[model samples]
Target: MAKMTHMKKQENQKSHFNHISHKEALVLTKIQQIKHQKSMDYWKQLVIAQQQSGFSVTEYCRQQDIKYNAFYYWLRKIREEALESLPQLPEKSTTNPQVAVLSATTVTAAVQTQSSSLKLFCGPVSLEVNEQTSNEMLMQTLRCIKEVFGIC
Candidate 1:
């Protein structure tokens, strides 16, 4: 009697697996794809918010009750997707551009004119630093600036 019951259960399981029609299977696949896309979008937004919060990844993950590994995995996956979606740039020519050299006097004059503040240019971003800024604070500020702008 137990063997017969086991056989019946196996048959029921087989029938359940075979119950879905082709259209139903396709609908199920589409639903799964939508769910996966939503999950990816959620994680991508979380990563962006964490980056803008000015907290380290470890600290952010800890505060958010997220696993560090999962956060990093999503971050890497988002970056990879972005990189893959970018259009490839054309190759540069072999010709080198002329280099302009500034004289010491010119550099000195420029420095003298900006004696009260130091200007740092990174790509299109510019930062003005007061003369009283400490070395450690300056380094930290530069790091924060790079993080904000994603500069190399």
Candidate 2:
């Protein structure tokens, strides 16, 4: 009788596994697709908000209570999609684009005429550097800026 009861339990389990109808399976698939679309929309909104906020990614993510790694992952995915959508440049162009060439003397004259201060802009962040800034310090500062804004 114990053996017969065990066989009955196995049969019951098998029946439970096979209980879903084809229509029910289709409904489950639709539900999953909707959930996936909602997640994608959420990420897209986050990317847009970050861009418009004018703050660095780290700061923006922090203000929004988002994970830095997850924010970066979504940002990278969005940028990849944007890059893929852009028109491709021809491998061999019929006409070459005009290139501007500046001589050393021209550059020197321009630099001499301008103030000793240098200002660099990256999106919303602006960095001002003077001749007194050390090379190592400038390099380190630029690295930090790049990390925060993903650009210099």
Best by TM-score: 1
TM-score of decoy 2: 0.40
lDDT by residue (38-101, candidate 2, tens digit) is 7656787777568768898999989989999998887676556545544454587658876779
- Which regions of candidate 2 deviate over 4 angstroms? 1-18, 76-152
- For 65-102, candidate 1 gives per-residue lDDT tens digits of 99999988877776666555444557877798667799
Candidate 1: residue 147 Cα off by (Å): 19
RMSD of each: 11.4, 13.4
- The weakest ten consecutive residues by lDDT in model 1 span 143-152
- Angstrom error of the Cα, residue 107, model 2: value is 26
For candidate 2, the per-residue lDDT at 25 reads 80
TM-scores of all predicted structures: 0.47, 0.40
